[model samples]
Target: MWRRRAPLATACAAGEASLFVNGIDPGYSGDTAVYGALSLVTRADSILVQEVCDYGNYDDFDFTGTSMGFGLTRDDEPPPLFLPGVIISMFGGLVRNIAGHVGVELDEMRQRIEPWYTDERIECAMATIEPGQLAAVRFAAVGVCGGVPVITVEHVTRLTAAAAPHWPYPPDGHIGVHRVVVEGEPRVEVNTHVSHPVFDPTDAGCISTAARAVNTIDWVCRAPSGLFAVADIPPTELIRGVMW
Candidate 1:
């Protein structure tokens, strides 16, 4: 597997680098093709046997097919997206137009989860993403509150694995992942999407594939609570700590 891991803070500062799949571009590549190539990129893609699949089984809940809105803020920053009961996915990657436009509004329509703090308590914890075949961008923002850190993520893309955003797995293809670590808040937030639209799906599995990369690291800070809130943390108890 081809692998690249860098500090999320430094790489994202310039908006030049991506999270999981470093060099891959999301514009011109096929989503399924990217997932198939994971074995060559990180040598860890083979580990997935049943984890990545269609969401029809999950009451038809797919992350790739729909636009994603993820962010971290203090209890007072006004919920980023106002939509109710919306879950963000980390597996599904977003595609971008050549000029770099995501084509979606990230503003919170309604508050789904309450921010934990009010005093600038948000800072980028870390980003774990797959850049994709055409250089798709994944962003994570960080802020400080009461000396604590709050992290937020925003994704913009032109392609998707599903025709609709609520499908379980995209009719298209996706990337795989082994592990991801974001440092800065001592807490971890892992998010991923599992589906995409068929016509213009992009390879996001690369982000999942790079989750196990070892060279990357971020700073960890203390939070009001001891644990962070992320959706995609591997089940160490089930995997016996050998997730990849």
Candidate 2:
């Protein structure tokens, strides 16, 4: 368990650092490996989890076959094969051939733009995924304009029921599920978005936010349905209260 936890921890930490330094959310990159590893260990099968980044807006997660390793993004522009060879060819044909081979490897590595997720696809994924693995299937988007990270985890059963007649929101936005207590029994709540205060970048604040996010996800994933209970105040607010 500790070994399993280490990869995710490293990945999350790296992602947080990338967010602060590059203003790019690489969480999905790290998350891909974590999700893949989790699927393999839990199901004893190889699985490929790919993240499609819309660059500064939102990101979507979906599973693929093991053949699709570290799937490509739309932004990955391919290098010019013949053009580069032409330049080197002026120097020598041998050099040009070498360059072409290198170009081939580069092209192989670059992934094609991943397609956007649809409501039907997400619903299907949710239905097929093991309850315990739901957490890894979650999607998150950091608002580049606002720098706020909105994390979304789904409960398929709840979401399907919620969309009894029709789901109102766009498919992309329907990534979250909520928890509520009704008649002394726990139930899935729909159409609720949980917002937490943006973590302050101060050393202490970052540490606190990371810890709480980990703890919260762990608790939520273990629940019967994959959702977190709403808090009156953001968890960061609570941390501030205690720290201050």
Highest TM-score among the candidates is held by which one? 2
**Across residues 136-223, which tens digit of lDDT does each residue of candidate 1 receive?**
2122222222343322222222223221233233223443211222332232223234334542112344433343332121211211
lDDT of each: 0.25, 0.25
Per-prediction TM-score to the true structure, in the order listed: 0.19, 0.20
Q: RMSD per prediction, one decimal?
A: 19.6, 20.4
Q: For model 2, state the Cα shift of residue 88 in Å.
A: 23
CA deviation > 4 Å runs, candidate 1: 1-63, 68-143, 146-150, 154-238, 241-244
Off by over 4 Å in 2: 1-24, 32-45, 52-110, 114-194, 197-244
